[model samples]
Target chain A: MRHSGYQIWLLTLSLAAATLGAIVYATGMGHIAVPASEIIRVIAARVTSNPALLAGIDPVFPFVVFDVRLPRILTSTLVGGGLAMSGVIYQGILLNPLADPYTLGVSSGAAFGAALALLANLTMMGHFSVPLFAFGGAALTLLVVLYLSSFNGQISANTLILSGVIVGAILAAGISFLKYLADEQVAVIIFWLMGSFASRTWLDVTVVAMAVVFGLGLSFFYARDLNILSLGSRSADTLGVESGRVRWILLLGASLVTAVCVSVSGIIGFIGLIVPHLMRFLVGPDNRKLLPVSILAGALLLLVADTVTRAVLPVEVPIGVLTALIGGPFFCVIFRKRQRRVA
Target chain B: MSATSGFGLSGVSFDYGTTPALVDLDLCLPPGKFYGIVGPNGCGKTTFLDMLTGSKSPDRGSVTFMDRPVAEYRRRDLARLVALVPQDFGIDFAYTVQEVVLMGRHPYIGRFASPGAEDWRQVDAAMAAIGISHFKDRFVNELSGGEKQRVVVARALAQQTQFLLFDEATSSLDVQYTMQIFNVARNLVRGEGRTVIAVIHNLNLAAAYCDEIIFMQAGKVVACGPSDSVLESSMIKKVFGVESRVEVDDFSKTKQISFRYWS
Candidate 1:
């Protein structure tokens, strides 16, 4: 269970390299197949401000790589990383192996908001309206969960999760009601709820990138505290961690990351829950190592899934459905193996 | 009112909602001695330790260490001065013993910095002191109850605090492991000039090793003094509502108590 610093660094670097490789390889796969060399050359030409590298490639290839593929790929990658990072924080703070980014009902809140926006056909804010509403709903849900769980200024894990379940059930009902009201536009809401990465713009990538990067920094800064927190709040307090304050800060950070990612990507379910568990098995339970590894692994996993759907499959399936279909069975296997070991 | 060393509590009172856990308790504990807080169930022994460690702030009065209010110190600063080995220590993850022990150095290590050579040295010395260096790399969850408790004690030792508090830490251990932990605490006091206070349920074990004993009853201190003076038959009768015989051991010259019950 103990990995040396050298081993952790090597694993982290390897994962990072693999993620970069996956991004390039996935970008090249499409209806008009761009080669990996062409993808790399286009990216290098753009980054180095040297159009010379682009001279030999097809003129449409750079546009396809940058406008068509790169944005969707990067957005999915960042969203995956964000969700997985949030998952690590949530599990660490709540001290539950089953905890994920959506454990606090953030996804339910976001889905409800999106469904409402869709039913109302509110385009006042243009493309940003749905995501804005989704983010607002998610933030509000977290606040309610925190308020419900806190007693005498202390937030216990059990009560917090209980409140989340209670609130999430109510919001799920609300989302169904919105779907019922949609009637003719119901398919729009249903497709969105299923989630997809098609036609994702650069704006989505930028917003997700900011949130994920900031979240990574925040989670890493408190990674050691998160490790101590697994010892329970009392032990964490005795070790100089102001458990309540640190928990609040981390909860907010993780929730914000989750809210933004869900707003952009609809409801990608299992990346958050599964990636952290998988990375913990590899890097051990140290959050300092687990956080970085999970981020890279999540990005790689989701990018591969999205690529398989967008290019490998005869028809594109919604990214959310694909992840759940795959992740549900995978998670069950992990659970069964763990149960046997514990027994 | 302002003692320069050790812990000082004056008129300290705390309540969980309407039920008082500690009531109007005033006490001063000096340095470099092993003190035991002995009381029956529902008494305020654990709460008192909570106040001393600054984990709980007294609702009414004041709790101080080194002439300053404990509530005023930053958590990390206070952690450098006091460490507590709590009851019911359980880790949910598969953290290695060395990793768990090294967590005691959290206050000393920087936010962005990993444990340095000095931190590792202290951690190694602590594990070695508790004779757990052999399993330092073993997962803590895989260890037995006694082994886990030793690891916890090693963590506290790595903290290197002047004040060490144990809240019924040996309540779950076998007698041999209990003696092992108590021996470690005794060495910390007699050999290193550190203060060790433990809330002990086993009055016999408390009487055996503690330099002084404080008996609590109904959320108030009934008696506090040297072991021989405070651990008499009458004090036991008053605090525990039971009859007991107390005597000085022939070999160790320490007070020993035996309880009597209805046949």
Candidate 2:
């Protein structure tokens, strides 16, 4: 039976409210220790075009909220939402519950590209060069995977996945070799591979925002077709999905989403894999509902992870490790719970 | 054949890497009748069904429906006219029976549009017709093979198409499910003027239900006519290399075949 529209709307509204709350709550928890009220005041002062609200607040408040914390917070949140969105698309189009952005080796390809940039010292373009190379690597990997998997004008989902693993494995080796070439720069490459939100500026936020928003907009347009697709390609095609074309578009589209997310934040893990499954349990399997809700839930999850590591922990850990360390156990608990229910 | 009422394939052929799957095959399928195509394995029955449904195009000839080239219809447009029930009912997600059936209305619903009440009505009516209304709330994985097959049929029915194609849809089911699916199709053909073409492996099931049967061998049709006329022992022996006895079943008054020996 269909999920209640009223309930779905309420759930979505709650998530939206919670995500907004998460941003506010996380912004205040950093070392500078801006209170939640001051955090809101800083934002309110900026939006209302009144500098009076900033008076008597610690002079560091505006700088910390706007320059120090918010960008990192926003970037991580958007990247999380973006990764989850790509996860939803990949799982839906490939018709495999196991599929995610990394399932197709997109992250490996991006890391290899970023590694090459770091090794070669391609700093003339400055911060832009690494992400540019990363996008190139991801787009190229997608094309290669499609080429290797396609047969008689159709890309079999199994072949595509298998080919992704093969190509990803080779790229992983390439990244390792690049690490050796980097010598002293190996530290930077390793840090990048571990993934973080440190020192991210508004530029990174803008880049991820544009890509995720445009790609997700396109995905929502095809949301209904994606729903039909989980029934398998033949049924989807017979139901008027133009399954081949839709799959290709959504595959490349999801890859593009992954490309941007990796470019901004390096390879933050598990948000993609964990969010969709969790959201499916809550929202039912409808992509229309799942995609939007997963977007919010992913943002909240990643923001919390970023906050705990950046502030709550005594020593800063890579956000990627935090996600995996945190998300892995959560995923297992949920998976076990589901299995028991099934049994 | 009338200009606008039957499927016509003339001089059609297909090959899989130079191995011919179909060769210069010609067929005319009249609307409003239930037809079955049966043959030994590798006789291209599935391929023929594929071409009829526009899933595959012939290499050397054209297939037309209702006097229009099958290729000319847009995917969504053709979907309104033809729906296929694939043999595999495999789905990765654990959507409910209603969710699965509602997908049949995808062609009618626009992008960014959820299933409206009318679409839900069609889904409900289709499920009821297939006798699956009671299972509407159950997850599809919880269903029995026969119940799942009915859900599949309900999805096809919800497509609201003019032509229904079944590609070994009941191949994995037992005798009961086979008859159950066939009975559903039979009602569509008899009660409504809808056309159905099923590629079946069971000769007895084909003989019992199909109004007209086509017998194929080596990608070429060896017999095509009324079931009673074409399903005799001589054609069965010639095409299947099997000696068999064909007689009407007293219970259903339909042709029943009893196999003797393989040649």
Candidate 3:
């Protein structure tokens, strides 16, 4: 069984690699028509071996492949991977497979924060302030949820969910207040609300990259605790897990990862909820393998969605819309199958 | 505290906030004996198990395992010695039985070190021992209640600890499966010399399976001794408020409680 698992994982990796490469090459082909050869040349040049060839290549091809397409692709990859990983961690921690960034209200809180900052012209100083305040909002909302959920020290699952819903409602109300106060830029505010990866740069990608890497690192360390937690908190404690401490750390880490991803790319939904479920079906529920696999699958899925949105229509479709379109049906299929199994 | 104190509870007590769950409880179990705790619901059976397993710290005193205060042992070290098989588990993810069993090896795994061939061998052996080798690759969440309970026991076995605690591991199981599990536990104690402690509800089941029985009522131990001695008709009536006939099984020399009250 174990050997079969390794073989299956290797197979998954190969499939993911192929899918990722195809999406990149195909997506790079459209609009700009950067040839496959040029794409490869630029990639190879960027990596090593032949800088002179890369330098000799047309600056337009290099610019299109490296600067424009790569950042966008990388952004989708980071955000998708981060969201999926966060989803896995949250599900394990909560013992609820339905949990995701949105369930915890981190997305709504960050969106409200980003909207507040953007609409109020707080970003007038710089674009970085938007993400900074968005992260702050996410963290603050998490603190509020944690505080509200704790009943004399123990955090019940019901209380946690209820707290998140309440906090999310409050944040949404705040966003509406901002919307009402705004005289113009309602379009930009609405765009932010709907979600987008429209304007990504290397810096945005770097910020998301750091958050994902850091969150994934924290998750790996807590993965064992998470497995114990899945047994239920009392049992987890019997297994010598510091249940409360581990929970707080994981919840905070997952929320932080979600906030950073949303701040950079705007609330990309469904990837978090769907990617982990798909990965769990493929790999067993062990977080050790589930997390990394979900990250890869999520990146691939979101990249495909974004690529399709860009290619399917002349007008740019918000990446969020495309994800929900694909994710919603996929989610229904899973839910239906689960209902049948339960029945 | 001696080097061989397997488990010791000194004046331990617990409360569900204001309501007391356990009061002035004291227990000492040497490392290598099969022991049983028998009680009804709301009698603190689960709470006692929680205290013994470090899930709930005592409100007053402390529990010591292996000569070290349980609180002093790091979570990892505590797991190496004591393994718990909880009554029920909720699994959201569909981990295969083998994978679930392999997680018992978590404490032993070093950083960046994946489970090697030997670890898989141990897991396979555990699965085979529990008669669930056929279900090694099957999703755990998909298993029936009895099968899932066995898988949990197999996980505890894979932990390879000297001390194993079962919190009513077989309550939901059918008669044959329950007997099969207890037989396994008996073998672990008699054949392998491992210490086993179980919180069992059915007095007849405990009488048949346990070598020694501790009867609890109202957060305290009412009677404790060899199964026959602790499982008397008087003690059963006193603790459970139910009249019962106690008969000695000739083959096993165990006292079996037969309830007379229908209503």
Q: List RMSD in Å for every model shown.
A: 2.7, 3.0, 3.5
Clashing pairs in 3: none
**Candidate 3 lDDT, A222-279, residue by residue in tens:** 8877887888787677566788799988988888888888887777777888988877
lDDT of 2 at A120: 82
Instruction: Kindly report which residue stretches of model 3 are placed more than 4 angstroms away from their true locations once superposed.
Output: A1-3, A19-30, A40-67, A119-129, A139-170, A339-343, B1-4
For model 3, how does the per-residue alpha-carbon lDDT over B71-125 read when each residue is reduced to its tens digit?
8878878888888999886675777888788878777776568888877787888
Q: Candidate 2 — which residues are off by over 4 angstroms?
A: A1-4, A118-129, A143-166, A327-343, B1-4, B261-263
Q: Write the per-residue lDDT of candidate 1 for residues A29-137, one digit (tens) a residue.
A: 8898999988989999999999999987999999999999999999999999998998898889877676675667877787777667767877999876776677678
Model 2's TM-score against the true structure:
0.92
Pairs clashing within candidate 2: none
**Model number with the top TM-score:** 1
**Residue range A16-120, candidate 2, lDDT tens digits:** 999999999899987788899999999999889899999889998899999989999999999989889988988787665556767577777877887787678
Error of 3 at B161 (Å): 1.5
What is candidate 1's lDDT per residue for B1-263, written digit by digit as tens? 22358998899999999999999999989888999999899898888988987878999999989988999999999889999998867676889999999999999999989789999999999999888999998998788877888888899999999999998888778888788889988988899888999999888888888989999987899899999788889888888888899998897677788778775
User: What DockQ does each candidate score versus the true complex, computed on alpha carbons?
Assistant: 0.77, 0.72, 0.55
Question: What is the DockQ of the complex in model 2?
Answer: 0.72
